[model samples]
Target: MSSRVQVVEQPGLAPAGLDPDAAYAALAARDRRFDGRIWFGVTSTGVYCRPVCPAQTPKAQNVRFFAAPAAAVSAGFRACRRCRPDSAPGSRHWDHRGDLVGRALRLIADGAIDDGGVAGLARTLHVSERHLHRSLVAEVGAGPLQLAVSRRAQTAKLLVEQTDLSLAEIAFASGFSSVRQFNDVMRREFGIAPSGLRRTPSERIPSADPALVLRLRLRPPYDADALGAFLAARTVAGLEEHVPGRRWTHRRVVPLPTRAAVTEVTVHGDHVVVRSGADVRDTAALVRRVRRWLDLDADPATVDAALGLDPALAPLVGAHPGLRVPTTVDPWETVVRAVVGQQVSVAAAGTLLARLVAAHGTEVAGESGLRAFPRPAAIAALDPAAITGMPGSRARTLVALAAAVADGSVALGSPDLDEVEAALLAIPGAGPWTTGYVRLRALADPDAFPASDLGLRHAAGALGLPEAARALGAHVSAWSPWRSYAAQHLWTSLAPAPVKEPS
Candidate 1:
């Protein structure tokens, strides 16, 4: 069953790096490996589909390839009903690419377009609107607005299928300007009204609770237990908690743009269930944050393949196949954590952060027994002497860093990694390890490696690699572009092996 299609030069039709021949091959074979990597639109049906679409493959002449779903939509193709490409795991390409288009897409997914229009997004990226548009169109085959529209439609569709929220609430929550616009966009994108996408009662996953529960899809081989343990060890008392139960469940107060919500996340085999009490309008943003925090969009196979090449990392990769570098839901909170974590144990840092949260964190409106992490302004306004646990110099550094973020001198949301790194390094007491750790988790830099980290150095020494920071840094260069995952593997290796009971 060698399904093949003739790939012609469709100049300006496909994204820059996508090979039409390879894309068509994947599509024809219904390859699951290419699920999020590529999409195709059929001229006859005027519909786009995921690579793993179960439908019959179309003719070569009528097929067109796109790197992103937004590109297909922008080219006047509706989503395929059968495959539901909108719910596919996000492309791993975005994880490593720090290019202008990549950065723009990251911000767009985070609701930057909904919060601020195209012009504002461009300004944040330090680019002119025209330049930004041209670059995205050239590389991604769609401009910012089309991408945003596609995102909204996907969010709306997810809400329609999963939740019992009203159409009006879904519209507002998905960032549509009005209910009519939501209906119009939904119909235009999916060739169906919003209500038409809903699942029957029998098809819905059952939940006994009243909370808004949503299933987030992810690539497989996820080491949920390992990731949970990492978060559990560093859990701040009032802000986040990990329950001891049959399933690994973590509850945390997520501060969304519109409001703060308490999210209860339970990790399953292939996906994680998110239960939240936030307003419907914040669902889309909350989903994005949860995905990012859990590092769910990662293609573990790809990362494993790359890092597994090294002799030292091969055993690690074999031992823990899908370990993830746990990221932050809030960039500011991560920055605070990174600064406080410098030269201190993880437990000590968590204890100090809990105290800080108790002193300055704002209470959630409806949720009792939880508080959001203190905002930068609150920390920045503090007197240096007020921070009780840490050294006075470190206290000054935290306040300085907080003030820098509070006043917009440091843009955590910026896509430009170099600029962000420079700003962080400029803050007094923020060293390579602090900035690198922030880049690793908060900013989601895949290549971010804090070579000077004590844990990393110690792990490298134990692995028979170079023990010194400089030597270890040089040795780990072979694991470039996925050093973050490599770091996770190394850190996990440091944990004590579980004791066997007379097996």
Candidate 2:
């Protein structure tokens, strides 16, 4: 193998621009910013670790840096026991790119591989299995299966450390098919059996109930207040709930592959506590969706540094250092929400969506009082004339979108943003704003900006920039690649000031 790192010249997967020397420097300094962006394997000990791993740093000559954790494992290295590199927040480098590698990574993280296997994943990406395997190996130093294996190991380790799920439960929950396979993979990845990886009693969270409680890590300075407020303001009555305060709690019905489960998230300091009763088969998928929903994988320091360069946005960036564009767990829900929200105020949109959910959504079991957002098939069955409280045109648009989604003509799971956008635009009533908003929240496209939005236009005009969509788009071009964060900053400026309570 060459001493130099090999990358496939992709846009966002350049290891965050770190060469071997720079990667070593970051590793030696235990830099938190580079924690997820790069991993270095120790040639001597044959273990890989995050840059922020607290163990003794290996000699520079003994280190080989990789852009992904799967690469290290593929290169014959176990995870560092002390550092638990598998627990590192996901790299934001891959979050925004619409490329093949980026999309593949996203799907793999979402348990596409576990659900359907490598052949299935290739089919979804519309590539030959051979081509997909080769591309992934060249770009990220691992094939799709290897990447999925690494992900499963990570999930299993997390369950071992955090939840009190039985070993068999953890195995299946992490996407392993058999206990033997799970044990072998765990030993190979971590140099220990699954049981050996469990945390001490004092360190573990007490699992007194059936709910799987896990603490998801966030790259700080996370603005929990800002994220909570954004979700709370637009919460649908039967589908979501938010209890607002200094430390807020948000709950929503998440539709998993096997079934729909209600998931609860509470903000605790640097991390959020996630409580879910999802099936063991769906636990890994639920965790990945929760991470996306919370925007926990973002590199706040890098985003803030980039946006802070603009004088107009500098103040907003400074005020809300880690303000995230809160995304959705279900892309269909986002599409429906975006379409229904058109030409209507946020409050009105929520009321209308609530009506739809109550009428068509699947109610959760027991008395949680939550209902999963109506799936496309459910909504597609309704006649446009039956959708109350919305204009006929908008109602027709919603049904049309539902039919498209139900038919797989508009694949929300597709990695190709342009293709998805084109298909969405083909719907009769879906316009630029609807497509743009879907791209931003549903697809988690960081550069996605609904420039036509009145709120965004007003926010830009207040900042002394152009108010027209075309002009504002031009002005905000400098915020490229990070425009989603820039948009959040702008919209946040228009929010009413919070009342101060007596100290």
Model 1 CA deviation exceeding 4 Å by range: 1-9, 12-18, 205-210, 497-503
Candidate 1: tens digits of C-alpha lDDT, residues 371-392: 9999999999999998999999
Output the lDDT of residue 240, model 2.
87
For candidate 2, write residues 90-187 as lDDT tens digits.
86687678788898998888888877999999998899999999988877888999999998998888889887778998897777889999999988
Query: How well does each candidate superpose onto the true structure, as a TM-score?
Result: 0.93, 0.94
CA lDDT scores, all candidates in order = 0.85, 0.85
Q: Measure candidate 2: CA RMSD.
A: 3.2
Model 2 spans > 4 angstroms off: 1-14, 499-503
lDDT against true structure, model 1: 0.85
Residue 369 lDDT in model 2?
97
Give the number of colliding residue pairs in candidate 1: 1
Measured with C-alpha atoms, the lDDT of residue 361 in candidate 2 is 90
lDDT of 2 at 393: 94
